[model samples]
Target: MSTYLTILGYNSAIPTVNASPTAQFLDMEERAFLIDCGEGTQVQLRKAKVRFSKINHIFISHLHGDHCFGLPGLIASFRLLGRDTALNVYGPKGIKEMMETIFRLTETHKGFEVIYHELKSKSSEKIYEDSRIEVFTIPLDHRIYCNGYLFREKPKERHLNMKEISKYPEIQTCDYHHIKSGRDFELSDGYVLKNSILTTDPTDPISYAFCSDTRYWEEVIPLIENVDVLYHESTFLHDLKEMADHTGHTTALEAARIARKANVGKLILGHFSNRYSDLSVFTDEAREVFPNTFLPKALEAVKIG
Candidate 1:
């Protein structure tokens, strides 16, 4: 199964010549999930070559314009494309009212069902789940009712040893299911073969945590501990830490510190302030604390094991 993250836009607050707002596309096991539908997100999606019809679910971190402004436009575009599949949108409370107001004012009618899942809990909770992955809400310490998302791959089934299965002519193709399910096999003579002898251990599950538009919040460490990849917002550098704290946003140093504390495998810093023309400074500052930090470019896809 293929799993990766496509960063469409990473800028904070507004769109600029060099940067846009917060938007991302996560491809997990071929399933598409839109993270934050910032302004011009649909354009970014087109630039990323993402199929609009594949994105059935969208997770909005907050009601900020930079974070969710493109949602209505994207939904309307979906209707224009003649999409029939139901779309599920997960976001904080008041999102339904906000979207409904936009639809009412624009007189736009959706040809497909749009399901809104409102999030209100302060604690961590599972908001979405499928056969292969699960998404949870990470309560953030932002000025508004913001949230982060944690995407975790479910435990995979063990791999079947084809050579071992071929050794027994009696083992039919249908019985491979039982072997992959970690069940022992019995022969006509009552001889039993252990499941371990027929199958190899499955690969470890992977996890990705998305933390944006928040302050230096340490309470989330336990929930995101040891994740495979962590995309944390570094809205400012350490030099502007005072402003970061006042605005309820994290600096590059603070984001790196959280990654170090959480012991995540990789740390991706984004949601940069447009004031700084050069973004390498953010990477330089973050690397001072966490050496595994990375500053991803727009449309870059980072592979996760």
Candidate 2:
């Protein structure tokens, strides 16, 4: 039941005194997922007090240096820390070769295992499916081979009402599945118990999307519409709108526009450019278009609820 998102880094292209590059940690239940390992991501994780050992998966949005430059260091650190768990890395093609070369040159032998899942940059697909959640790829409009990730919680079965079910002594215990499925229970005396009177609807599953270092692409609207939380890259403010578009980055206002169009519950704007000394402009500009917008600070944890 413990689910939260921690911002490891929020700067773009460069590191500042108060922020690093792009990185985030998604914690759900007993596992954690790392999103975009920028420079010094491992250090940020330590400062945030995140249990890095629990991270079994890493998702890279693109091959951009600001987005994934710290991956090699993190992998090395994992080995130095004596990790024995297998780590799965999901990203666009060439990532495997990139990591392989880094390891080959440094003669770094991992104590565990590393699996690379090359994602298609052109299409959307169900990349990972598990009992608790499903992860899908979201094609993004970026200069390099890139894609986003969408996390959706799986549906859960209904909770049985033990008190009400205990009253029906004649009802067979073998038919519990049927009773949980909303079927009425029949007794030996021709009495019946209504399912609606005993059971209630389960909690609705929540979803979150991560899109980094991309331009304003409307194609993502259908896939991420009405998501519980959306973390979009806002590398520049409106003052540098033309520069942002030319560099294949988004402005704060543009990010907010996408969240508004998608009707997401909350919008988290990150990947800020280092030219700006203050971040108030980013928040104010995004809030102009979408009121439920927030600017994440480095190592700050944001809950979707």
Best by TM-score: 1
Model 2 regions more than 4 Å off:
170-194
> For candidate 1, which ten residues in a row score worst on lDDT?
12-21
* Tens digit per residue, CA lDDT, model 1, 115-202: 9999999999999888999999999999999999999999888999998888999899999888887899998899999999999999
Number of colliding residue pairs in each model: 0, 0
lDDT values for all models: 0.93, 0.86
Report the lDDT of model 2 for residue 277.
Answer: 78
**lDDT for model 2, on a 0 to 1 scale?**
0.86
Candidate 1 C-alpha error for residue 279, in Å: 0.9
| Residue 163 shift from truth in candidate 2, angstroms | 5.0
Residue-level lDDT tens digits of model 2 in 1-305: 75689999988888877888988999865458999999989999999998778889999988889889999999999999999989999998889999999899989998889999988758789988877888988898888878989988877556677777777767666877786677887677777778875566657777889998788888888989999999998988988889988988889999999999999999999887777778888889999999999988777777765
